[model samples]
Target: MDPAVLREDMVDGLESATKDVLQDEAVAVAMRDVPRHEFFDDERLAYADREHEVLGTRVLSPRTVARVLQALALEDDDSVLIVGAGVGYTAAVVAELVGATNVHAVDISRPIVIEARQNLERAGYDGVLVDCRDGAQGFPEYAPFDRILLEAAAVEPPRAVLEQLSADGRLVFPRGSQRQRLEAISATGDRTRFEAVSFAPLLVDGEQSGTLERNRMAREDREHAVRRAESRRGWEQDWIEWEHSVSSR
Candidate 1:
């Protein structure tokens, strides 16, 4: 079967009555144009709409990608920053909508970043820049992105990422911890919530795969411990906000 034919079938399924996930005509068209099979060794399964695991990070399903892009509402030439560029599949799809040079991606896992860069190049999108960075911090070198996409869930969307949005820019992310919703926030601070979804929590420094510390809670525990240590009489003040004054420390 030709890859083009497979992509057409994939788009058809996404637009079908049962799925109806790819409602945006531009999103559907861009997705159809991207060579998703190039990102996979087994091209046969590339068109499957289910999530796949790679480098200890979950590759978002096609429906999830559709939802994110729809929420982003990307325009031609819109600069996109992908916070969790796992296999670079979403970035490649975005490159179809926005030029390859306009797509910037970052991942907390170094290996994933390297792999994502390679994957994007293999998918014929070599101009998309993929970097190793904390997803919370975002890719600030190219700050003021027209559109930003966070592929992981967070209880509170990182303020740094929000700050990186261009004036009138939009951010799409899975918000919440145990329960998550597809949320889009504009640079002007208006929020739009979409359907409920589940995604793994975002990773931070020293917590990525193959790192010494598997403790993702270390940052919070450290913050609370510091608060206790700094207390006048150990427990003088309650730890209502675990991240109070964390930046100064």
Candidate 2:
């Protein structure tokens, strides 16, 4: 299979399907520049009709990749932190969008990290850092990133990741359990806000701490009960306050 042809097809498909969805010329160019076939090991399947699933863990469809790149809104000068950087395919594509010098790809699997390094290098993205670490725990050593993308899904956006974003920085990932929704989180002042959309759930390893899981479930139930109580409080005082503020304005 010719990688060039496969890459062109994927780029052309993205160009046609996402022309309106993704209005960035740089992202379009980056899609065209990066060869997707190089990321897959199956030569015959590289250009096959099926979506490319890396290491049987993470799936990277052309459309999904395009959407992620578009969501990132990467600038040439911006630095990006990519979690769940499987085999560096998404990382390589992202590196193209944000310049190799400004991209760092992190993955938990050591061998996969090595594969990612090779893939990036093979795709002429040698400058991109492909590091091995627990991606759930954002790389604090390089905190305050201009942008962050988690290729895998999480029950909720990791607190560490939210803290790592620079002011106004964007973070995209899937949030939810049985029903995952795509979310775009942005850091504003000392707080982070999120907008929910939809995407496929990312493949992530289960938590190792049983105690943490039990505690998290308990906290979630408590929070849910509190929210229900608060909603039931009937906007009485809050509604009056809001009305007064609106009238004054």
Candidate 3:
């Protein structure tokens, strides 16, 4: 069967299961347009409505992707920061909605980030920046994002991510150490909880060490990461304020 047909069927299942998730026309369109199969080697599992493990990471189910996109409520010109990019399927979908140049995806796993970049480029979404870095920091160079998405579950939505949101922006992630519940937060700090969801726990800096047979990052990419790290040091003051704000909540 054509992957497009498979994608449509996937969306159909999503819509039938939870109409609220596909209520956003743009989200539905992007979900249908992005080639989900391109990100998966297992064609059968790609079309299934369940999470599939890929390269030590989990490609979130179509249902979860749809809900995250719907919660984001992205606009065409919006800039987005996506954490836990996995193999970039969710980033690809978001790129279709907000345009490729407006999206940035980051992951702590170096091999996974490399795979995500390759997958996205092969899928013709090379414009979306995929970075290998600590997702907890939330990409400060791209601060004030219109939307932020976290595919991994955390004890709480990182305040750093909330700080990245522009005024009136939306952030979505599953929260809880165990028994996570998907939640959406407004830029103003109001949070709304939704259905229970499961995801790998968000790992930070040293906690993300892993060996997956991929070689070290290319020299140029390594240099870029170093540069970003240097700049990140300057964001510490802003991080302090964000931390204080969340502490009050």
Q: Which candidate gets the maximum TM-score versus the true structure? A: 1
TM values, all candidates:
0.85, 0.72, 0.80
Off by over 4 Å in 3: 17-21, 209-249
TM-score of 2: 0.72
lDDT of 1: 0.82
50-158 per-residue lDDT for model 3 (tens digits): 8887776878888888877777778878999999989999999999988999999999887889999999998889999999887878899988899999888877777
Model 3 scores a TM of 0.80
Q: Determine which window of 10 residues in candidate 1 has minimal summed lDDT.
A: 209-218
Clashing pairs in 3: none
Residues forming the 10-long window of minimal summed lDDT in candidate 3: 240-249
Q: How many residue pairs clash in each candidate?
A: 0, 1, 0
Best by lDDT: 1
Off by more than 4 A, model 2 = 17-23, 47-50, 189-249
TM-score of 1: 0.85
CA RMSD of all predictions? 6.8, 13.3, 10.8
Candidate 3, RMSD to the unseen true structure: 10.8
Candidate 1 per-residue lDDT, tens place, 1-249, comes to: 899999999999999999888889999999999989888877778888888888788888888889888999999999999988999999998999989999999987778888888888888999999988777788888988999998888766688889999998999998887789999999998999999998888766535553222224446745655555565464543423222354555
